[model samples]
Target: MLRRTGIPLLALAVFAGPALAGCGGGEPEESAADLLSRAKTTLDDASSAHFVLDSEGAPNSGTLLVGGEGDIARPASFEGTLNVRALGSTLDLEVVSVDGTVYAQLPFASGFSVVDPAQFGFGDPGALLDPDTGISQLLAEAENAELGEERRVDGDVVREVTAELPGDLVEQILASQDPSQAVQARFSIATETGELRRAELTGPFFTAEDDATYTVELSDFGADVEITAPPTG
Candidate 1:
């Protein structure tokens, strides 16, 4: 009776060993370059997305853009509010961009008026989602990309990537005083969807003497968003 029981148990153990090994063997993790490529493709394919921009360690003086939150639609359309720091005061301005025209309702103003985006120390927000000159471009041009540990962001599993971006490339999206200094960029991309969740940049954006940090959070991809030029009357 003992011999018979021992033989059956040994056979069962041999069969279970292979099955257990197979369970642990899934697809290999993606390389940092490949992951960034996928993320860039995902952003380029998105029709519309919501974004929030924030900055830290900015100089106390001078006219600077500090924060902004808005929705951007493809083919150049954006509706959002920008926080500008001028003369030690933070001014919130409502802005709209459509058809290559930018309009803003300045403080103490009755209505929107045509304005140049650079006057506020920033570039056109509407072009942020443009495939050629937008955040996707940064991902495509990242150098020495390296994947970091995964973390949970806003309830989504995301993998972090560390890389360096050319200051000239960054200047196309935001204002930069020195385009010769390289910017350190950290990107958090969603593992499941390949969508870019957050981007942190550190460089000499406002002045060459000091390095400031800017953080951008992106979400709400493919949302039903309609952006039209505001009446300037």
Candidate 2:
């Protein structure tokens, strides 16, 4: 999944850093469940917001712009536009899907493609930005969440947290991380605002078919944004 759609899925694993960072840690803080509750409360108060995601790889980096509306899980929808420059080439993936059909647009492409709604699952940029799905849920569930330790991502500081993501939630988190049974990923929430700051899943690097690490950081909120999907695809 990660290899086939490297540009799109990259956001799933590495985009939560800013939100989690907003949930800075200091000392003993709230419980995991408490943190999730508080984070949801804060999210409920937001009608709309912006997010910026950066993914780091050897010798290069990628950026994504995500805009979300409505509440996590029940969000009317979301839009994500990703710009990536790596290996001496630039690629852009623009996705917006609300209702049923999904729209996908790419750089150097004449136009967008209308495809089956299923194609846009977590693998697509639309679901990647939706609160009910992908990293959005992880961030919204971050209230009262605990912390583990601090780590470095793209030269930035990040903290760890642990919690259970049941049912569909489990699928979303796992899809983003691309974890195997050998790898154990611990999900965590922020202590200050109960936001999901960091989730660490450790195993072997470059061993999975995905050819990427199973870790991710999500962050950067309230940025300039615009997202629109074709009515039908």
Candidate 1: residue 215 Cα off by (Å) = 0.5
Candidate topping lDDT: 1
Candidate 1, 1-233: lDDT as tens digits: 99999998999999999998999999898999999999999999999999999999888788899999999999899999999998888889899999678999998899999999888888888888888888899999999999998999999999999999999999889867898999999999999999999999999988987899999999999999999887888
Model 1 steric clash total: 0
Residues 1-233 of candidate 2 have per-residue lDDT tens digits of: 65889976768657777777768865665554555566555554444444444332312332211122221122444565544443444455565655444566754666777755333223443454455655557555433345566555445543455543332353444333233323334554444444444455443232234323344444443333444556532
Question: What's the lDDT for candidate 2?
Answer: 0.45
Candidate 2 residues lying further than 4 Å off, grouped into runs, are 1-28, 52-74, 83-91, 116-124, 127-146, 150-159, 164-170, 173-192, 197-211, 214-226, 230-233
lDDT of each: 0.92, 0.45
TM-score per model over all chains: 0.92, 0.48
